[model samples]
Target: MENVAILVDGAFFIKRALHIFGKLTPDELASKLCSYSEKHLARDRKGERNKLYRIFFYDCPPLQNKVFHPYHQQQIDMAKSERSIWRLQFHDELRKKRKMALRLGRIDDINVTWRINYDKIKKLCSGRLKWHDLKEEDFSMDVKQKGVDMRIGIDITSLALKKQVTQIVLISGDSDFVPAAKFARREGIDFILDPMWAPIKEDLYEHIDGLRSTFPKPCNKKKLESSY
Candidate 1:
């Protein structure tokens, strides 16, 4: 029997799931992932079950305070936020799940800088902006996730090269994985991409062996975010 390995972009999945499924607990998230893979991704063309090699979830530890609201100039308390709390809980759940591997990336959270948006800068230059008029999305944050993409790429390549799994199902919408996907496919792995019912580019489609989404597309599809 063929073996399938499920790779999840944890940050992407969490953000997307919260937006679409409305704040599922960690258990719900794990169950959904398992259910989806077993019922959909881990199936052969002949409708046979594939052995689940492992489920790898990649993410970074949440920012450890020190961030601030650019406009308000108030320190953002990540610890007290419900989102942060739930994410930690979710990580714990992943740790406890059978055959689940939680691969964490380092958070480049040492610096807190706000890079102003292009439009906002234009507005500022035109003297059309005031301190009180600024909104959160008017600027970009520089909190980078170090090593996440690299780790994911390495894992995919390793899985393919070592022949650990015949099939790989990647649950991510990020096009950043294109090269890795191509490599996996070249290695004779059945590479599948699950964007959680999100639309992918034509270029991405050409690289993967198949596209599958275990979840149903939202009825309010337009309102759902295209990517995380």
Candidate 2:
């Protein structure tokens, strides 16, 4: 049986899951993540169930400082905010799961600011709506995660160099991992990409061993299929 390590890009997974599968509770999300990952361990055409080495989840802790919201016209305490509370609970739930390691990065609070949503920005650009028509819901905090990508790269390199796992399944749509994927493949580690049914560029095919999405395909039928 192949030994496999699953690495999850927490933000990407959460965003995609909310869009495709609707809202789920903190515990529900954790359970769903585990269940989805376990599917990769199912027997292959060779009839061998892959053994799980471990699961690495990368994310940034929610911002805990008070920040002014220009659209809402109020100062918000993010530490007590609904999203922050939910994230804290979700992290706690993940800690109790076996074979799961949460690698938390820091949020760039120094440069954090409110930014208009992409949809609203597009509407404004197309003259479909004016800036005055924007509402509080049209704005979201723009936060850049620090150290998350570095941690992911480091983990992948470590796994490959140490010969820890025969395969690495990365659950992310970001192409920043291409270099790491190349290194892992050179080390004889089977690198798999799971974009969660999101469309990927044709150029991304050469870096990985295979592509597979464990979830149902999204409504848009223009996604790139598995490269296996």
Error of 2 at 90 (Å): 0.7
**Regions more than 4 Å wrong, model 1:** 41-47, 114-142, 221-228
Q: Model 2 over residues 51-76: C-alpha lDDT tens digits?
A: 99999999989989988889877888
Angstrom error at residue 167, model 1: 0.5
Tens-digit per-residue lDDT, 121-217, candidate 1: 8888899987667786576566688999999999999999999999999999999998998999999999988898777788888998888887766
Model 1 residue 47 CA deviation (Å) reads 5.4
TM-score of each: 0.83, 0.91
In candidate 1 the C-alpha lDDT for residue 89 amounts to 77
TM-score of 2: 0.91
Clash totals, every prediction = 0, 0
lDDT by candidate, in order shown:
0.80, 0.88
